[model samples]
Target chain A: MELAQRILVVIRFECRRGMILSRVATALVLAVFPLALVLLVRTQGGDLETGPRGPGILFALLPGLTCLMCLLLWAIPAIHSEVEGSTWPYLAVRPGGKSAVLLGKYLTAVAWTTAVGWLGVSLCAMTMRLSDRLETWCVLGILILLSALAYGALFVLLGVVFLRRAMVLAVGYAFIMEFLTGFIPAVIHRFTIQYHLRSLLSQWTGWTPASLGGAFHQLSLFSPWPAWGHLLALLGGTAALLAAAGCILRQRELIKPESE
Target chain B: MDGPAGTMILLEHVTKLYGTVIGVNDLTASLPQGAYGLVGPNGSGKSTLLNLLTGQLRPTLGRIAVLGQPPWNNARLCQRLGVCPEQDAFYPNITPLEWVRYLLELQGFSGSEASERAEAALEQVGLAETRRRPLGECSRGMRQRAKLAQALAHDPSLLILDEPFAAVDPLGRRRMVELIRRRIAEGKGVVIASHLLHEVEAVTDRFLLICGGRLLASGTAEEVYALLEELPKEVRLRADQPRRLARQLLETELADAVRLTGRDELVVSTDSPGRLYRQLPQLVDRAGVRVFELRAAEGSLQALFDALLRIHRGMKILQPRD
Candidate 1:
């Protein structure tokens, strides 16, 4: 088969396998988790728009927390599970087969995470009563896509590099690099995916608050990079990481003694 | 690419090492078309050799070619190679049909063509009835058949199976043996590995023996058994008038040491099996002894392996200071 067709086979296989009722239900619950928080805050007589900047707590929850969480859950296991499950050798022998499998799995993780991110952001925007739903959806939609791509690529790299320790390493990277380091008011903060995402979020949404809270307010201190700049960086970063992962996979032997 | 002259697989001074532990040592071998068994004990590099042959692993310090091309990352050559690994893993929650079809599609076959081949392969492995069932729900034996189905689904020119009879029962083993024979009969070359001596013996008389990641021997069963010239062999005979038979055998020096086990049974141990066998019939005829059964006291392969292993250990113990 052509490389595209082989990739599609894997995509179809992954998507078909992901449609189990239990998995779908878990994804739905996770997609709704942030939206549930929005509803909870509203029920407590708090205004959804009461936050100091951005799309209040709803944006933070949807594109910020939910997107990262879903992709982490979906993308990290995308390749590691196959390697750990001893299914990689079966696929690795085909002509140009490893790239096909890797790209297919990467694409599948992006699709699933992107889908869930869109669902969560849509419901969050609806519940929070954003004035311009289209613009909110558009900006959040792009951020969600970018987040999925960047996190999916990084997680795939982690899966390739650290086969057994991928999940722990990814969780550490997510918590430290994406969450904690992204908020620090320093040049190092710019290294995080969250930095570009927040930069893009601020640039597109036009939410330049004078003063807010803690690091959330400090994020407004840095000059917002042009929307194109952040988008380009995210795309370039994702491509570089994925290509590196492919190279690593081609170089490393995936088989272990136990598997033999 | 066509294979070299008459050779299907050729390895020249191939050595594979995993850190300090060796997987396959400095070894060279050439296998021709038709069927051959790879026999070895666990961790003796049977799977490692098959992996190298299938292009799943590369040699550390030598060259390997299957059908005239290096197997490492050689996609074109991989199209002509199929491997059934020892691990029992299948794509999760999917029917065997879908799994097999997907693998065939990866080999560049279109969906419909892949489906047809998958069905036929599954049928050949006797999985036609349960082809639609989820692999996770299948028995160990059925799953083994499924593994074979996928490997054969592409109908590659060379089929390499690693420990194909690992977890199979007697009946399943018989079925697998038949399937392997059928594949070989179709003019495709096969290299099957198993630690089970009887399993490999049942499939092919031509076999290779590997131990300590080295090629110990390779030939027909009789030829390999002939390598055990240093080891004594015991043969038991049950016959009427056994005393007369034993007396003739002792007088001729044919029996190195003969012991009477029962009223009509004699166990004879000899270093020269050929001379003993040549003299046994004459002695029985001269004594008018009616021989009912003549059997090796131990499994030939097992006894040879034990002797080789003992010599190997002896060499290890006698090693010079590093």
Candidate 2:
């Protein structure tokens, strides 16, 4: 009960601190950014129905760009802010405080990213007249949420393990692992978050060779497993990453060596 | 306050190593429930020892039990421990009221109780008026006071403060001293560490002096001085007839050496300060010297530390020869 109270306090603190108007505005803009791009492409006479690139662009915008941006802007910096500001010691010294703080901030990041990412996906899907396809919209929403959770947890882990350099390393990992390796037909791509997200999208959206254009054959991506397997893997991955982050935070000293 | 076994803090053969450098080496001590000043210069392992006792840092070797429980990851023990770190960083954008209130809430205090305690603690620290102002706008002294307020807001059993008096003015330091004295009077235990000797002495006479990652000494100032009986004491006197006083001091054999420091000042070195003090009046009367001021030149805390360091080094030098 006491630990729960502590975690609540941290949640309140982080949430309150995160309510900066400028940052919120930036998130709002980022949320609508993909929708505007899609509309611009459509107005420029890119036949949305016939173009092979339509679904790919939408997938990139809704789940790929949105998840990466939200995690980078919110989750990765959750713990980095404390270490940079030299405030870790104050929180870490509390009873169960370190883990509570980690969990609270992790929740904050997940919520922030999910809310913004959903806003982006919903607006994008609506603008493209895809709202009529209720199943596709629901699947996209779930995929956006799952992406936020997985990416948020991974970024939180990165932030805890490498305080100052977490941002650069996370960006690098996203580019190499999520973007580059995710589409490879090899089994190694299964380890990347993007693979699971794309797999789920392919399975849910039913992106056949015609919808995906010549790119599907060229990429030679593996067929996605059952949606339940993808869902379980994502959920299990988030929990494991979050737990790893908490465990490392509890055992490691909060002291900055440079400050010492 | 020392009951049969009410030891508030016990560090047995504790050592903390920061990579290759030693933070604290083989420190061992047991302190009862009361106020104790941990005094040392900067980089003298004062903060390291405080962090160890607070359970913020685990010892590389040995163990520490505070309030009968190990501090590392021990939430039950931490509930009774409050720490005011020496670092200047804080939630800079938040007001002291919100910051302290949030900290107390984390300690399991309900909303109203946390607010009440936070207000009271801020008031006790003399930050009542500007408690709502952002901490970034507060002066360094005010920030220090605010940090102290949060440390006390939870009403922990043992308050461990690192450099509590840093950046505080003389008046502020006095107020802090009074506050600490009040807490001790209330029977709460406190372990306050600082680089300044007089600041620590202002609050508690029971102290531990550390240097070079070692426990140089621990006790009252008088007791520490007692250990230096072999060292000659220097007393400076300002007299109307300084030369006459110096002559009388030498003639009476009360001083080992007498020298004129100024036109009206005499510096006398004596192996036996008690005998010189006892015979000083007669010596002044015989010489027709009117003494205006008299003080022990080498009785300050820094001087004591210097002497102890010299003695320690001298012993080290003699070890090889022996």
Candidate 3:
């Protein structure tokens, strides 16, 4: 069998095995979070205009934040879960086993989080009565996919690097690079996934600096490329991170200690 | 990367150290394709050696080659080797059939082929009736069979098992022994590591005795038992006149030392058991003693192992015959 076929097998079985009650509940909660947030703003009679609390800013944050959180739950502990469960050796002994497992789990994470993110954004768009509801849904859907792919690959790489502490390290990386540094109007912000995602959101939705008041408007000044440029960056970044993860996993000895 | 022809495994001065502790101390052996038992006490580096052969660990010093190639990260080599690890962990929610099928798929089998082979392997391990049951809910013996099924499902040329019968009952053990013997009959190599002497003895006569992470001896069962002849042996006898028979044997110098254990029983320790056995009837008849029972107590592998350990420690256990 080809490597891709083996990976597909892993994905098929893993997705089936991941349908336990706890994960199902977590997926439900992720999909409902944005809808709940939108309902809360509407119930409180907050402004839905083009501002800090507008639909554009709200939908923009949904994909990046939601996808990152979802990938943290799935991809950040991919290898660690196998090792802790004592199932890694069985998989590690197969031909192309490490790469197949990593890539399969990474794709599953992306697919899972992207679906959840899309559901959340679609429900939020419907709840807010936006003027350009279809455009808003399409842009957010694409962004959710890009964010899931990018962040899933990033967290999978972190998982291979720091087996036990991948979650803590991933959260730290998100806070420093995506949350804080990504918003700064400098060349360094472009290196963050959040920056390219925000750039694409602003470019696609025609939300300019003057119309959106607050730190959100500053995002437009740093992005100079067309929308396709940011899309390619996200896709290219995902591939690069995944390749690095595969190489590291192949070279590293990820066996559990003999005491286990 | 083929190794020397007919050599199943080759280790040259291999040593594994876990920080400050030694796991496998300077060990060297060359084993050909056949069924062999790796007998050792707990923490005696049996698992460590198995791991090294399976490419799970790198030796701290020296070299190891399995099937003519170094095992470390050798994916092609892995395709020819199957290992049933000592750890008894499995995904709790999936059935044995699903787990085995997934492992076969990872071995590059297509979905239909993997499922078919998985079913056949489970059936061979006598798990066909319960293959669909959740592994976590299965009995320890059933779960052990599931582990073996996954290893055998790949149909590798070599099987390395670490304590395969640890939690199995007598009947289950017999089934496993028969299954392993069938593999050996097919010319497939098998290496079983266990602390149970009789369990390994049932499957293979070739034995490698290890203690304190060192190779004490390696040969056939008869070769190991022949070592016991050089050591002292104790024989027990039931007689009509225990004291009279004991005195007669002592007087004739056939028994090194004899003690009357009961009204009609005596224990004798001897350095030359062959001479004692040959002359025992004459000595008893001369004393008018009727012997009812006679048994040698120190002719087992356990005794030989104990004697070897004693010799390894530089203890003087050999008795001189006069």
Candidate 4:
């Protein structure tokens, strides 16, 4: 079979298995988390209509926190879960089985996190009273999709590299690269996924750096390219990460340790 | 390069190392297209070799080929090979039908063909009624059968099964043995790895005895048994007038050493058990010994393995007289 068809089969079964009560509950909770935070702020009489806090909070909560958390929950354990469950040998024996499984699970994680992010952003958009609510919703929706794809590929690579401690390693990477380095106004920040995402958010939504003021204004200057440049970078980086993951998975022996 | 034709599996000094531990060490074998029993004790590297054959692992050193092609990362070769691993694990929520169908699809079978083949294979393994049940709900034996079903679903020419009968009951074991025999009769090749000697013996006469990650011996059951004959065999005899019987055997030169374990029982060590069996009745009649029980002390396959291990370790083994 073609590789794409094989990957689709994996995606189908993975999505079906994802519908179990526990997993569905977790997904729902993740989807509602941003909405819950938004409602809590609204109930506390916080002003979301003025200043940059509304878009900033929406970007951070929707694409920023939601995408990272969902990928951690799903993508980072893709290979580890199969090995731990002892189900990897079954998949590993098929033609192109290893690559099919990795790509398929990566796509599933992206789909899952993107859907959850969209739902949370939609819920928050409906509840919040902003002047440019539709534009904010559209921009955040696109960012969430980009975030899921980029973060999903990164976490899948981490899972393939560090099978046992993939989740821990992924969290550390997210903290160091996407959270810490991304916020710094240096050339190194451009290498982080969060940097392009922040650039896209500022350029597309008209939420100028001056609105946030001070140190946040420096981020805009560091990422001076138009929206397409950021889009190309995110998409190109995702493809490169996935390709590297495929190469590593093929070369590495993912067999479980011999019990004999 | 492709392997020599008609060779089902070929290995040349293949070695697999896990960190500092050796899984398969300098293993070399060329097996023809037929049924083979890979026999070994626990920690004997049977699973490791199977993994190497199925491409789940890459040998740390040397080379391996299955079905005329290298197995590692050889997707085309995988199309002709099926493997049922030792681990019994499956997605808990999916039914056996779904699981088998999914695997078949991964093998490139279309949806309809995969379903039809999956159903037929499940039925062949006596899991027709439980095919639709969630794997988590199935018993271990049923799950084991499901594993076999998936392996057979592809209908590959070569089937590599590791400990296939681990959790199967006696009746289920009988059915599986018959099924494997049927596959063999169809001119397909099968390699069954098991720690149980008799289980593999029932399915295939060709045996590969492995120990400590090394190939100790390989041939038919009788060929392996012939190795046991070269060693001294002890026979226990329970009879009245045991001392008289012992004296008669020693005097006749039929027994090498004799010891009285009880008032009525004597153990005899002999180099020629066949001759001793043939002449035992006459010796008993001459001694007026009423014999009650007689049996060889070390006649099992395990004893054969023990003797082979001894020889492999450079220990002395007795040679039969010409």
Q: Write the per-residue lDDT of candidate 1 for residues B84-145, one digit (tens) a residue.
A: 88888766688889888888988889899999999999898788999999988888888888
**Better candidate number, 1 or 4, judged by DockQ:** 4
Cα TM-score of candidate 1: 0.91
The best candidate in terms of lDDT: 4
Chain B of model 3: TM-score?
0.87
lDDT of 4 by residue, A38-114 (tens): 77877898765455777888888889998999999999999889988989889999999999999999999999999
DockQ class, candidate 3: medium
- TM-score, candidate 3, is 0.89
Could you tell me the TM-score of candidate 2?
0.89
Native interface contacts kept by each candidate, as a fraction: 0.46, 0.51, 0.51, 0.86
Superposition error at B198 for model 1 (Å)? 2.9
For model 3, residues B194-220, the per-residue Cα lDDT tens digits are 998888899999988888788887888
lDDT of each: 0.81, 0.80, 0.84, 0.88
Tens digit of lDDT per residue, candidate 3, span A103-192? 999999888998888888777777766767778889888888888999999999999999989999999999999888886778888999
Q: Report clashes for each candidate as comma-separated counts.
A: 1, 0, 1, 0
Best by DockQ: 4
TM-score order, best first, reads 4, 1, 2, 3
Docking class of 4: medium
- Which of 2 and 4 is the better model by DockQ? 4
Candidate 4 lDDT, B168-191, residue by residue in tens: 999988999999999999999999
List, for all models, the DockQ compared with the true complex.
0.61, 0.56, 0.51, 0.76
Candidate 3 local Cα displacement, residue B103, angstroms: 1.1
Q: In candidate 3, how many Å is residue A33 off? A: 0.8
What is the fnat score of candidate 2?
0.51
